[model samples]
Target: MALFGLFRRKPHERLGFELYGAAVRAARQPVFFTELAVPDTLDGRFDLIGLQVALLIRRLHRDPDPRGPGIAQAVFDAMFADMDFNLREMGVGDMSIARRVKNMWEAFHGRAQAYEAPLQSGDGAALAEALARNVWRGALPADAAQPRRLAALALATDTSLAAQPLDALLRGEARFPALEEAPHDRDAGA
Candidate 1:
């Protein structure tokens, strides 16, 4: 049984891995660093990926499809698994990795809560403030445009996710709006 288990992954787990990869690809968009000014540091990267995952999870939660909850759990499991791998690669000791992962989970949940209300409300300023506080870690750029741009992207992402069918999302085929198509002004509205 153990050997068979090693060879066969649950379908949801496979889907989760695929979804995580999609989130990573979305987070790596060069526009985030070049135009949005999201820092290219480890935390910065994680935050972006986390945001993508959170948006997916949020959409799943609202979906009435029977598979929605299972897919959501799978995506969450994939995220923590990736966190574990990253921690080990960063040379964190096994004993400390668990604690660090726990902290990261807490942080991720906090961020989700922070962004959820504003995103749902379609309030651009509120979303910008949330992104500024969470993603930028309170070190908002002097120009103010960067956070606004990020907020616009977040709004677009939310809309894009909402447009995807639950079945497609459960199949790990998530899509986000192109950065070039992201809104540029607060008036653009979520």
Candidate 2:
């Protein structure tokens, strides 16, 4: 007959907390402090929340020591190459795809920098939260009903450094003038 006992939701709350704890546990990894830390190279231009998430993912997934120098650049080159091929299969030409991909990478870099600037100027946790918000926004799947694909994205995204598929990552927000498709040529009556 205890009122306290009747009101107790502690068990349910605890279970919920533990579930989240396990998820974070699954994401955990060790990496160099400097490597995991947001690079000074950002120089303050991108979204803070997104950059923090990027750093968090980088810390969890990237190796502190790579086989060669410029490992980041090499990784980016391979990612863009894959993106280029995908674009080509979708009917974009090699030159157009290359240009668009390069522009998108630059935009990503710039966005990182924008977020970093405010962080260095004294916004810390606020900046991290903002970046987290942006990350969540970016994480929304174009099609939400694909649960299997969504779960894979949740897992893959937590450790991924690859830019999103070009269609999402590029096609404007991160670039100038925007990409316009060329009109198809019509043949004279057969």
Candidate 3:
């Protein structure tokens, strides 16, 4: 029992996990599926969750606090841990789990980087193209409207996350906005 206690997570790690959970819930919101037409498949869910987490990581890396980077890392660890668990739950062979997860990590990293510049520069078209290429997973569409909407949502989501205080984020509380009305003020309640 004491040995198990010795392995317990620190308070901050717990907060990291709580924050990750919030991201997961926000990603699962129905607007992405029903309105934005994000496929509700397993891969789609994974991408949405990954995108949400990436946004948080972006904000955390920019955070002034010394603990920000560590919290971002903890959230990342929790995300991959959930992925591994989900793969096992689906009965992926033990021998293949590591390889599959590595592939997922690579994919996620690539997508995250693809999003970084567009997000930083606030280039909606570039972000839309990236989202279309990744989310649609096929040839570029003739009409870019589909992914354009998603890009708008992503930008709005980022704005909402940015409005929240670092202290609120450190405490594992986040308030993602509604699909239509976003951009609330900083003092808004979670």
Candidate 4:
């Protein structure tokens, strides 16, 4: 059994790390921090990473290909492993690491659930509401413009993900819409 395990290659391990790297890149977009008013704190960064990861997972779940699920699981494993390493780097004690990781997992799952409905519905209002509640954490900006812009960006991201080929996603070649290209609501005249 041990020999078999050693001989078996984890099919998506490398691709999973690549995908996680992509997610991290998406999370670190400068526009999100400067234009969108996303706080630069740890919580804000985590939320952005969680959002990107959730979107990728959602795309995987909706893919008809049989390999989608396996790739998705590998992506998830990569994400949590990165998170664990990050926590340790931040000086979290060994005894507290497991509990902190569990809490982060719960948070990620909750955010995924919150994002799923709006993303599936393709409704701007619903997407805005979900982002406000979760991303902004009920502390929406004094003006509604930032939230509106973020909602538009989120929709663009959803569309971009939907358009990616399943094979590309599985190969860790997924791409997100650039922030500058996120469409604004014409009706709002902004």
Candidate 5:
């Protein structure tokens, strides 16, 4: 028996990789940096990506389907794999890459957990404050409105993802809200 077989990834893993791609694209929207004033640094980019992925994971976990948790795990695995590749591309030493990736994983998990409470309670202000702390990285901006806008985006994403069909999500068709309009207005046709 072969210890490692060809095409080993289960179907959910492939769907997860595709879903991660969708999250990355959603996170890369220029409006986040230009209009919302999210810092354009690498850390800023990662923060946005984390937020988007966390939303997807949240949606997956809420599903009644039993495969939801497994799919979420696959999405997370795909994320770390991409991050490892990025680190390698940046010329990080092999000896330290694992450590750095671990740190990033912790940060992502921490922020995701922190954001969930406010989202569950439907407290926009709490969510905005959480965003300010994480996105701003402790140097709170003079313009409080920026983080609030980010929080709005996050909330809109939650609503948008919730509205998406579970089957669509399973097919890796998760769609973020349009930057040009509120989520409720955009999903009104659905």
Candidate 6:
């Protein structure tokens, strides 16, 4: 039982943080959807958003394209601000907020390969498009498209990369209370 402590968490949990962080770093543009788990009941909300951002950003980073780099980067930046605000509104605390955010990032990052693998093989468009519409369309559409379209537009427009180090930045440790020194009356020539 003692040895299990080192291997307790699932593989995804153990390395997801760094993996997600890397995905975030690799992106050349910001993603539009930065907030992960909102106060709602939806599946793949955050993961899909992250993947969409990654794919578009990855392409922009690799090859300098006119349409890909500029706007994509802007969107990614905006996503982060929105994410921070949303998280705060969700009533997250300083101590665990970073961990939660980072964990979610890692989970999405780890899952990115699954989402992206199909794109490489030209078989991912459907799933990709489905994920996109579900995430960005505001209202979840109820159409019988059978094999749904996983649109890449959301990926092309997300801005999650803008606000980073959210956990590190929000942690209470970063803001130690201002230190007060013993009162010394310099004006009185003490």
lDDT of 4 at 126: 68
Residue range 83-180, candidate 2, lDDT tens digits: 46657887987668878777756755655554454333433333333333343333433223222222222323332323333222212111111001
lDDT order of candidates, top first = 1, 5, 4, 3, 6, 2
Q: What is the TM-score of each candidate against the true structure?
A: 0.91, 0.33, 0.87, 0.91, 0.90, 0.40
Each prediction's whole-model lDDT (CA): 0.84, 0.34, 0.80, 0.81, 0.83, 0.39
Report the C-alpha lDDT of model 3 over 1-190, residue by residue, as the tens digit. 8899998986467777888899899889898788767788988898888888998888888888898889888888888888999999999999999999999999889999999988888766777788878887744461355577667767777777888898999889987666566422121111
- Tell me which of candidates 3 and 6 scores higher on lDDT: 3
User: Per the 3 Å backbone cut-off, how many clashing residue pairs does candidate 3 have?
Assistant: 0
TM-score, predicted candidate 6 vs. hidden true structure = 0.40
Q: How does model 1 fare in lDDT?
A: 0.84
Runs in model 5 deviating more than 4 A are 5-7, 141-143, 183-190
- Candidate 3: give the clashing pairs: none
* Error at 159, model 3, angstroms: 1.7
Candidate 5 lDDT over 1-190, as tens digits, reads 4657664776588888999999999999998888777889989999999999999999889888898888888889899999999999999999999999999999999999999987777666777777888888856652366676677678888888888988898878999875665433123221
Off by over 4 Å in 3: 1-11, 139-143, 182-190
Superposed model 1: Cα runs more than 4 Å off: 1-11, 141-143
Model 2 misplacement above 4 A: 1-69, 117-190
Instruction: Give the C-alpha miss distance for residue 83 in model 1, angstroms.
Output: 0.9
Q: Report the lDDT tens digits of candidate 4 across residue range 3-57.
A: 8999786878888889879988988998888988888888889988988888888
Name the best candidate (by lDDT). Answer: 1
Q: Name the regions of candidate 4 deviating beyond 4 angstroms.
A: 3-9, 141-143, 186-190
User: Which lDDT tens digits does candidate 6 get at residues 85-186?
Assistant: 568888888777778767665654555555565444444344444444544443433232211223332222222222223333122111111101111122
